[model samples]
Target chain A: MEHFIETIGRNMFAIFGVMALVGGLLMIASKSAIHSVLGFLFAMLNIAGCFLALEAEFLGVAQILVYAGGIVVLFLFVVMLVEVSKKKEGEVFQLQSRYAVAAVAVGAAMFLAVFRKAFFGVASPEALVLRPELAKGLDVAHQNAQAVSRGLFADYLLPFEILSVILLVALVGAVVLAKTERV
Target chain B: MVSLNAVLLISFLLFSIGIAGVLIRRNALIILMCVELMLNAANLNFIAFARHNGSVAGQAFALLVMGFAAAEVAVGLALVVALYRRRDTVQVDDINLLKG
Candidate 1:
């Protein structure tokens, strides 16, 4: 009975994981661009669920806000703003689809082989050695948001600030690129 | 508790699917979405590892990754818009300049 309960506990994350994969597949396989975006949205939400399952509460919320609220909206606006004439069904996908799928399969196999050889694989040790700065680790609070905030504000402040500048630059670059009239 | 292996497996599958999508799709926008799928897979790995290590750094890095993904999508979609303006098509195969 105890083992059964534990299995159920583990299955929750599995459900989210499966849904995420399905969503990603849907995003890729859809014919219409809007349909593809909708599929991507489904996948993003399920990924947030996966984050929450991993107990990364803050990260989960940020995923929804950034991807769902902001990124998807941007994609939708572009889909609407641009008057892209949908090509004929035969031309929707690139030529030689079967060959591309095969190549991707080979690529995925190589990817798996390389990563499995390098990283601490599934059978890795639980006690991973973190950086000395963050080795202090989460406190007794054990709060997901607290730990993440401490990491960002206390340890990663410089990168955090630099990221802001990057976002600003990207914002300016986007405006310049998408401007209607050229100077 | 989700095992580290399970999470890793999920991330791997998601990433493979993303790669296939990118190669198979001709729409620039959908290809961009496939790229987002790949990024999410990487982020999933980060959070899973963070949880496994009982540290906050993985989550922290995931947050940073999210920011980068946002900035990336902004620039990429802008490029898509620019492409549309010049040639009026979002199909990648049609985005060639060697034609007469």
Candidate 2:
């Protein structure tokens, strides 16, 4: 039983690791609009699994449900609706040379700093907080679902409702913006 | 034990590539998709930190980021739809309606 539990944990981690690599590569290499959306979905799946490995099942579920299911579909629908028929001839972007270089340099440096902090700096503790029952091969996902519901109602009530309002506004705004101008 | 750093490093690289695509791609829809990539990269970082910290705050923030991303996508796609209606082209180079 213990061996089974350990194997499951390890397999989950390994899956996330490989998914991250493949998803990243695909997202980078995708030139087509549809391919990029699909790549992002794959990457989201990997990230959600990583959240599970980190013991945040609530986040893992939300990541898959909201990001992969909701956003990617919207992207594909929009891509299909808008046609890019012209040849890729003229410059598509207007990034200033110095600003672009600086942006990349700063982003890279920040990422490295963050990476060091996460893996090697003062914040390099795993701080594993597993419930005893959870470590004993019991399904954490079920418990997490209950806890997530309690958390949402108890502590996260306001933010939860606020998000719904935000979504409503966005839907309305999208309709308004997409409305054609009078002839 | 696979370190969180490894995951974060991959996320950063993905984000950089997305930014590059946004900068280099002339297709507006593709650029929007790249922007989505960038936001997802940030969300991954948030979830990793959430798991490491044994805190729910990271997940909360990630959800907020998701909401913002969704809203951004809506408005952005609407803009794309609007642009396509006005100019009949979705290419960035083709959008010169405002240029003098």
For A1-183, candidate 2 gives per-residue lDDT tens digits of: 999998877667557856865775676466666776788788778878877776667778887888788878887887777645644435534556668868888888987887776663333455333445433553433566554444445567788788889889989999999987774
For B24-100, candidate 2 gives per-residue lDDT tens digits of 66788778877877887788778677666655556666777888888888989999988888887887876876899
lDDT of 1 by residue, B1-100 (tens): 6678778889999998888888878888888988999999999999888878877778888999999999999999999998888888887888889867
Candidate 1 regions off by >4 Å? A1-8, A83-89, A95-100, A110-141, B98-100
Interface RMSD of 2: 3.6
Task: State how far residue A61 of model 1 sits from its true place (Å).
Answer: 0.8
C-alpha DockQ for predicted model 1 = 0.58
| lDDT of each candidate versus the true structure | 0.83, 0.72
Off by over 4 Å in 2: A1-18, A84-99, A113-142
Q: Model 2 compared with the native: what TM-score?
A: 0.76
**Candidate 1 chain B: 10-residue stretch with minimal lDDT:** B1-10
